[model samples]
Target: MQEINSIYPTDKKECYKLILAQLKSLLEDEPYVIPNLSNTSALLNGALTDINWVGFYLLHNNELLLGPFQGKTACVHIPIGKGVCGTAVQKDAIQLVKDVHEFPGHIACDSASRSEIVIPIHYNGQIVGVLDIDSPFIARFDSVDQEGLSELVNILEIACDWANVR
Candidate 1:
């Protein structure tokens, strides 16, 4: 097992680079989806600062179902086009909200979450799930976050065994 530092780099870009490297090391040769996602969530939660939630919401039966996560209790199901996670799936793009309260149709799983970023996860050319992260501070996520998290999701898209997951 590879070990990671609890301390995260101050630079957002470098932090994501390190986190992505750690993810690659963690997911290598791991064919299982649940465990891989579980570790991935935990890794993000640990590596990131000022984030209250980190997890995956997988698509199933035309709806988003809760998957592995590291945070307080969260909503179990969300319809496509509904909440941040659902919106990412519906639009097939990233939803980086500076203020959740300002977002139309925002779902507050945690009232403490003021900002959020949701990245759609695709596998085999099909939308499979989303990587959702939430922060307590408003405007916590910016363009740098959008790019970094998007790249992180890209790593997950390639690392996981989507055939078994879907």
Candidate 2:
């Protein structure tokens, strides 16, 4: 059985370091897609603080379909260029919004989400999915969070097989 050392350092950077190490252990030699995403979301949900939602939105056709997640029920589909998650894919960049209410076309899958960060996930030279995290407090995410989560997503990008994702 895999056991996560959930007790993380208060220092954000150190916390992420430990989180990444744990993720590597969990994903070692596992190339399957959905299970990896599911475990990743669960791991982040446990490691992160003050975040109410953490999940993935996979690219399908021209839209994003919700995949594995650890939170309340979410919007099943989001079009590219529409919400924060979609905007990340459309721009092919990270969307770190201090206040979701301030975003022009923010999609409120959870009304309580005040801040959000979306990172586009790439695989085999193409965008495959996204990592979407939400917090109830404004400005909950910052550059540190972005950098750390981005690294975590990078690990996901290489660890899972995307060709068979469905």
Candidate-wise lDDT, in order: 0.91, 0.93
What lDDT tens digits, residue by residue, belong to model 1 across residues 1-166? 5444447788999998888888889989887889988999999888888999999999999999999999999999999999888889999989999999999999999999999999999998999999999999999899988998888888888887899876
Model 1, which residues run further than 4 Å from truth? 1-6
Tens-digit lDDT string for candidate 2 (48-154): 88899999999998899999999999999999999999999999999999999999999998999999999999988789999999999999999999999999999
Ten-residue region with minimum lDDT total, candidate 2: 1-10
Q: RMSD (Cα, Å) of candidate 1?
A: 2.6
CA displacement after TM-score superposition, residue 24 of candidate 2 (Å): 0.3
Query: Residue 152, candidate 1: how far off, in angstroms?
Result: 1.3
Q: TM-score of the candidate numbered 1?
A: 0.94
Given candidate 1, what's the lDDT at residue 58? 93
Residue 118 lDDT (model 2)? 93
What TM-score does candidate 2 reach?
A: 0.95
What local lDDT does model 1 show for residue 25?
A: 95
